[model samples]
Target: MKFKVVEKFTSINGEGPLAGQLVVFIRFAGCNLNCSYCDTKWANKDNVCYDFMTSNDIYKYIKSTEIRNVTLTGGEPLLQEGIIELLELLSKDRSLHVEIETNGSIPLNEFGHIENPPSFTMDYKLPCSNMEDKMDLNNFHGLSPRDTVKFVCGTMEDVQKSKLIIDTYELSDKTNVYISPVFGQIDLEKIVGFMVYNKMNGINLQIQLHKIIWDQNKRGV
Candidate 1:
């Protein structure tokens, strides 16, 4: 089966635990949700131009890079028709570390059990995104420490909601939890103060390093 790939490039991961580290990014086309602060909205369009490549084609391109880190991103990589096949192919290479930057709406149960499954940087859409209701809470049931649950805060309410979800699910102990602001929308000092007041010990505050290193709107990074 052919996957609709929007672009492929080598760059430093801008978010998650792998931030600032070199990684091969294979961005697929299309998505199931649209968030207000989405930076990659161009790639999510149904009419977006893309290359029809088989799983092997993607694997070959990744191997050619000789980079150990491979990030299967989107539009929503999991939304691709044959993503599990692609993941399985990549897993055959023991040297490569794979991660999927997925929107939290999709269920992770099947993906989590795949052979040599890729690490997940799952987003837990907060109140501001207007997509929080779409999140699949069941996804949290199978997350390991290798996985991450990110909350993109755009307001004080988002921050408070993130804390509630973190505590309710005991996410800090189950998986890595991060609180990232919506770029220019939220104040870092307020987030820090809230964290301090609540003593949010295990959660992290992540910034998009790529956006800082390069133009925030520039693609193919």
Candidate 2:
């Protein structure tokens, strides 16, 4: 199977609980949803960095990076058919920690059954993204404690909606939940204040560390 690889580089795992670990990032092209706050708009566009390659090619390239941690990200990585095959190949190496970052709109039951399921960072798009209507809440049941659900909020309204979902799913008790502010859109101070006022527990706030170290718009870093 051929994978539409838009960018391949190494960087720190930028969000969720695994924020500081170094990782080899394989950013695939194509997505089913368009979020207003999306930073990788270049990868979301048509004909983006059209370098089609196979899973072995990706595996070989990843080995050359000499990094043990691997992350599969995307405009929406799962939208590509080869991702499962690629993931299967990558997961064979028990030494490498494989993680798959996916928007919550897609079904995840398959991954749940894998022998060495890659740890998941599933994103539950909030109202501001405009694609929240497409989110499949049932995906939450597919998560193990090893997975995390992230809500990217750009406004107070988004945070409010996120709280309701959190309560409905008892997400804080279910697994790791994260509320990340859309960079430059929501103030970090405001997010912290919300957590403090509510005495929020079981959930944590995360920032994209790569953006902090390098220019937010810089690619392949």
Candidate 3:
């Protein structure tokens, strides 16, 4: 099976729990949601260049990197049909720790039936994203403790939306939850204080480490 690819390269995890860890990122092309502040629009659906390679070809690239952790990111990797086959092949290499970053709109059950499931980094879009209606709350229910739910907030409204999602689903009991301010949009200190004053529990503040280290607008990390 083959898939459309935007780019692939070695970079630090850049977000969530694994931030700062070395990783090989395979960025698939295409996404259903078009968030207002999306930084990687260049990698979105319209710009995809087909990378017609077998799963083995991708595995070979990973093997050559000498990096054991692989991040299957996107333009929403789940939008591709061959993703399951690719994950199956990657799972054979027991030494590799696979991570899948998703937008948390599509149902995880659609992809989670694979023999070996990768650790998931699911982003729950807030109201400011403009794609909030696309979210399927059922997606959050499918997460295992190995997964994390992230909220990318740009305003107090966004934070309130995130809090509502967290409380509505009782997400804290299932897995790690994180709230991150949109890079350069909201003041970090304000977000931290808001979280504190609201008594929001079981949530960690995340920052885009890659943006801090490299050009914020650059692609391929």
Which one wins on TM-score?
A: 1
lDDT of 2 by residue, 1-221 (tens): 99899989988888877789889999998899899898888898896766888999999998998999888998889889857888888878888888888999889887665678798889999989999989988898767788899999999989888888988888888788999889888888887888888888887988888899999999888
Per residue, candidate 3 scores C-alpha lDDT tens digits across 1-221 of: 78877788998998887888999999888888899988877779574575766688889999999999899888898888868888888887889999999998878887667777788899988889988888888887788888999999999889888888888888888998999888999888888888899898888998999999999988878
Candidate 3 residue 146 Cα shift, in angstroms, is 0.5
Which pairs in model 2 have colliding backbones?
Answer: none
- Indicate the worst ten consecutive residues by lDDT in candidate 2: 110-119
- Which residue window of length 10 is worst by lDDT in model 1? 108-117
The TM-score obtained by model 3 is: 0.95
Q: What does the lDDT come to for candidate 1?
A: 0.92
Q: Candidate 1 lDDT, tens digit per residue, 78-179? A: 999978888888888989999999999988888756678899999999989999889999988889999999999999999999999999999999999999
Query: Roughly what TM-score does model 2 have, to 2 decimal places?
Result: 0.96
Error of 3 at 92 (Å): 2.0
| Candidate numbers sorted by TM-score from highest down | 1, 2, 3
Ordered by lDDT, highest first, the candidates read 1, 2, 3
Q: Against the true structure, candidate 3 has what lDDT?
A: 0.86
Model 2: residues >4 Å from true position, as ranges?
none
